[model samples]
Target: MATSSSQTLALQRNSSEQNRFMEKLMSKIFSFYDEQSLIDVTFKVSNPTALVPAHRLILAAASPYFENLFNGNQGTDPIIEINDIDSDIFERLITFCYTGQALITVDNVAAMLNAAIVLQMDDAKNRIVEYLMTRIDEYTLQSAYTLEHETKCEVLKQKIIEYETQNFIKISQSDEFLNFGAEKLQRILVSDNLNISREEDAFDAIQRWYNYDVPTRQQQLPLLIDCLRLTQFKVDFLMTHIQPLPGCELLAFKAVSWIREPTVRPMTNMRFTEPRGVSATNCGEKTILAVCSELNPKLQQYNKTEDKWQEYASINIDYGGYRTILKNDNLLFIGGWKSCATFNIVRSWNIRNKTWQNLPGMIQARRSHCVVELDDKIYAIGGRDGLSSVERYTTSDGWKLVNSLIDGRYDAGAVTLNGKIYIMGGYKIHNDKTNFYMDEHLQIKSVECYNPDSNTWTSCADMKLFHSSPGVAAHKGHIYVLGRGDEYSHVCVERYDPQQNTWSQICSLDVDPGYIACVLLDNKLWAIGGQSESAGKSCVSVFDEENFCWVERCLLPERKVCNCFVVPETLLFSM
Candidate 1:
């Protein structure tokens, strides 16, 4: 055993000595090559021709192109002519062959990468790809994308695509994006992973690209426009922007027809209607978004995994009673009141960018209105000042007055189920000649349903008791309304069945009623933050479907009149 151990130790020492010797020998070889000593082969690269000297053995060992050339050659020293590569790129590649190290920078990476691809140096190509990935940005993405096509580098291509998708808005505004060829622009526009809050931005990008070089790009407009999700565009946008663009008449007509009669006519292309990566429907991670009043401008997000609430983005203006709806990644804040003044202003908060934009306002300035999205359109229902008016917003046409409601009421609960919108009990004015002193309003138990296809409203079965400013959510084919009760501490829960046109009392919650926000998440109903008989409540409760009761989940950080909606979790944390 002692003799065997001694032999093993000797063998390890010898192996270590051999490795060090090889390292020294490689360094010497590289030094000689750097000094242009003992050069056996000369490479004459074209495009401002220049001669570069290298050792044949080192070149052959590092690249299969040189190995195959040397194996087929007959002379002791050979002169190789490379017509496609530049002299600087060829010299850099030869340096990589000798030292296994190359200076890769943004200025020359494209040319270097090309030379490496041509020489069949897999190691050099891989290193170049790694460097390119770290350096990819809006300025260099176009060059990288072009190199990807020229070299047929799948890895680089995928990385470029991912970067393009993530920073699409910024890239689209870059000079490189305007200079992109028709094919490259089409490749980006056709991506389902492009992170755009609205499809209008896609159209705007196309228009900008076209306007950059109208004479040359005009012919490609039709093909490029085909890549846009036409169904996602609002009717007004199509009419005002796309319809008059000369060649887009057909697409504009089609988009209008589809928006008006989506069920009547099947989409010409499914890809044009599919949502992008930033869309809530396509996002993998999701969270609950809580929008509080302007006084509490810090937005809150509920992390389901941790079961906690965290502060997210903030808004500048103070707002209350605004109805929020998620359209793709943009959370649309509809009509609401601020400082005793009602507003028709529509503000869009993009979850991906964490930026706010002013969209077209509604026709009616309203607060306490119920907003719901149906068939890719936003509908703002009745609100204060005895309003029975309804307005629908579309990306193509902006906001238009839709069919009026049957009974005008504010602080009503509204939710969508099975392609229809259901509005529950709300306060209504009761103008009586007998009461001469003051205007009287009372909470009513009337329910109405709106069908977008018919553009009409039909009365549904009324609830047992009136509920004003109640939290409403749709779960498992039933509409659940929580909290706003006539009597204090009598906050009742009720479920409405559209199929049977009936309402039933489910259970009562141990929290305040009105101003609560109810949302359907993970196949359950969650009621969050509202006012009670005494003060505002910050507690959150989830419906126990199996037991028909409200279960406490977690509490929010502060008590405020908050509107809760579900959004992609990435929108909350990624920004």
Candidate 2:
């Protein structure tokens, strides 16, 4: 909050002088240096050098990330130089060490961008890139494109085009990029060699990848559907040159599948081969939905005849409670149990890479939370901690701050529709300052929704009953709420319609229950896992939409607070 301009100038001048002196002093420590590699130069500025000690300089940079900066060790052998970096970067690096602030400008922006990108400074890189992406125009883009290599040029061009397509004016009428099409991307003066060929062939290649079938490719469909929306309409006449290959429809389906359900989950259990009470649809018609689940730990694909959930590739990551998931063509698992950590660790798993990487640690570590994938970003909602507190993280713009909930609770329900986030129920937030539990219970019944696009929260209609009361799921035109108390829970089902901004009582659940996690399958709503006195039930239960009956199904591997996701075949079912 210090707004003094003179103070800033003095601080900057001093910081710069100190770093330059340090660099100069380091140079003097070792004239035995290799100019090209820059690694042999010594930082003999340790204690007994008769100068301000190296330990002193390091102690100055003692932020938490310093451990990561030093490769997770607080102390290490002094290094003169690091590879693949120059003095220009070194100055900035030293600046970060000297002062925790990094200011952006016309000159150092490019280096800062590169460094942040390399070091996984995701938040910083996004800010720099977004700023550059917006200010640079056609002339600048053309210059960069022409000056850079083909691969790098393509990458920049695609990013600019995407920035434009996603945020700016996109000429939606074009055809080549329509539904897996990429039209003449740049209107440039180029030779024949630079031209792309088999334009229709690209379309054919995409269509074949999805293999559009329900049970088989259903999990993979959402992403493909989203991509289809922004695709520039390619020429129908171009179809003459683009012949549909034998299976190109599937590939095309796969292209759009990117936006379908979003986020591909790593395989947990093996394939599950069976569905309870799958009967002939009146005329000997069999229902085949290749539904994958998070709770059951189904053996891979469980196809008795061929029985294997074919996995082509996998990105190994440490994750659990498969319920907290989000996807905008990228699988982001926000919160999950890690036995080593006191709270759920936050991590991101790129669907394509299959590798899990650590993200910013949550402010309040939690478990059994809900996450939503919107616009290629994630929003983590409430879940109880050792003490319940609400927190969220989004990766789209690199984990920036958003508003938090008015109160904290666990077992709360969350859903995202039309870009707004809605949160319902859980335990009360503990006010350590007051040192008492507020039994008002008034906060528990309320509903609050946050808008990231505007960074604000507004009240919505509250449920007639307790949401933390148990068993909630969202389906076509409604959010189904079930259960009420713990040992004394209710099977009372209520439906919420966001459009009308109203709630209505639906058919009550027909099974024994204490708590339930509900998900929609086909037109029917399925509520699973609630405590009951039923002898044969193992917690897994289903509701008959048409028949209005609840059918108790076979048990999941264990009792769980299941968070269900139904990604159609294209988004996640294995080959």
Candidate 3:
């Protein structure tokens, strides 16, 4: 029995070896060889007419259409004329006839698929279809549709329909959607899977589509109206916006009924999805507030559309370590640590008047502190003084004392997340060491949270390391800290989940080194000019939390470390 099993295994090994040898031989035989070829196929593809040598036996075995044509009729000269097929595509199909493989590219897949269909090459057609489906995207959606319509590929059409339905909102915003006619637009919008965040988006798209051909598309409003969920619109929106428009009579009528009766069914019978366009810089086209903390400290307003930065005014004295906040179009510069001394002075820049005004000062002098606006009131946390005292400021009422921190340390990182203020990592004088001559300070890694509802501050899990003057920002309900480190160590980028009360270390900014002067812009963390190991070049690094990488964007005209803010398309860097 053992001898018989060994003999069977040996026979299988020889068969495998013979199969590999035959594959190599076939690969060589598939190479272009015109000498003593069976037939010549003349292809009129472009300006140049070319002839490709092909084997009848290989073509007949590969494609039934080619087999039938070759076997049917033959004259004295076996020269076949092939039309309406690209020369390169025909050549690739011929190669696949012999080699059982072909190079399918994005540019050539459509032509190749057409040729495969004409020649009845099922293997080739299946391969090209797979390639086309994978490459279908926003840029090629129109081309895919054209191919599907011409070829009558039901499968391809269905793939495109699914894609268009799923990404209707994204595709509708694209220029291609704008260019398409009312018929095509209606077909796309009719899908129940159309993922629109707001009913206003559909209204806006229809308005834009109508505006594209105002004179002609007016008649097509009914076709467009049927796709819109008019009943989903609110009463105020209908009255103030849609009702004012000339073509929204149907929408306005339905919106009135929807408001009077809450249970009214929408035209599409689908729930109205709220807008999800929230981002790091939600302020659109507003004048950006630029505050530069440097010698000859300047306050500026940046107009993104014009790409212009106009200086508002300069402070009376040079200042550094000051925190600026934009509150209701008013720019406020509060507390700073300068060469001379720490400042408690507070000033305001009126955006409308472009003038400066002195606001009521804080209860305590503080600099290198963190200040954030919560519930329309500004809360100033620990600063250079390393005091536990906290203060809140309002327009109606001046600065007043609030709840103090459990641990007082200056140069801490602070941000408001999920309606609560979180303060983390700073340093205080090490009084226990008795090393006053050495100027010793201890960096604290403790983190605390302050709830505005209870007006109380409580401790949470400590950070992985001490972060002194670290850049802090809240995005998607999580707080990210980057750049600043303890005196003895450099801090890695860290993310704090409020629910878990835990910190996880991300990558370090070795390339974009320095204290992180980061601000959330365009849903990305924009790290401005900071102290860098890279020759102190004023560099900008954009951190994509989704991809978990810091991408170097551009270098500043000068190596000036400044606090930066973004408004729409413009970025304001304050040195």
lDDT of each: 0.77, 0.45, 0.67
Model 1: per-residue Cα lDDT over 1-575, one tens digit each:
74474554554557767578779999999889878889888878887899999888887778768877888754355687778888888888888887778998888888887778778887788798889888776336767767887777655765776787778899889987887878767767777777788888888888889999899888788877877888777899889888887687888888788778756343232225445654565667667888766453668889898899888877766667677777766777888887789999998766655666778889999888888886557899999977999998865457899899999998888998766789988888886759677567778899999876578999988898888878888887688887656556646888887645678876688775545777878877888875544444477888775445578876877567457878777656664
lDDT of candidate 3 over 1-575, digit per residue (tens): 74474554554557767578778877666654434343455333442466777777677777778767777775223567777786778888887878677899998888888888788786787678777878776328778878977886544655676677678777777887778777667766655456677768777878877787788877777557656655566778778877666675765766577557654522212212212222213333433344555556665544445544566566565667777776533467788766668788887654434456677899888877778887557988887756888999854357999889988888788888756899998887666666556665678889999987678999998888777777788887688887555433333678897655678776666544454566765566766556455564445577754445677654443345445555433223221
Prediction 1 TM-score vs. true? 0.54
Model 3: CA > 4 A from native: 1-290, 298-316, 337-342, 351-353, 433-439, 486-491, 531-536, 558-562, 568-575
Best by TM-score: 1
Query: What order do candidates take by TM-score, descending?
Result: 1, 3, 2
Candidate 3, lDDT over the whole model: 0.67
Residue 190 deviation, candidate 2, in Å?
A: 28
lDDT of 2 by residue, 61-177 (tens): 333233344554424655533444444553444344333335666555566666554444334444555555666553354433343232232234445555434421122222323
TM-score of each model, paired residue for residue: 0.54, 0.43, 0.47
Leading candidate by lDDT: 1
Q: Which consecutive 10 residues in model 3 have the weakest lDDT in total? A: 268-277
Give RMSD to native, each candidate: 24.2, 22.8, 22.4
- Residue-level error in angstroms, candidate 2, position 223: 17
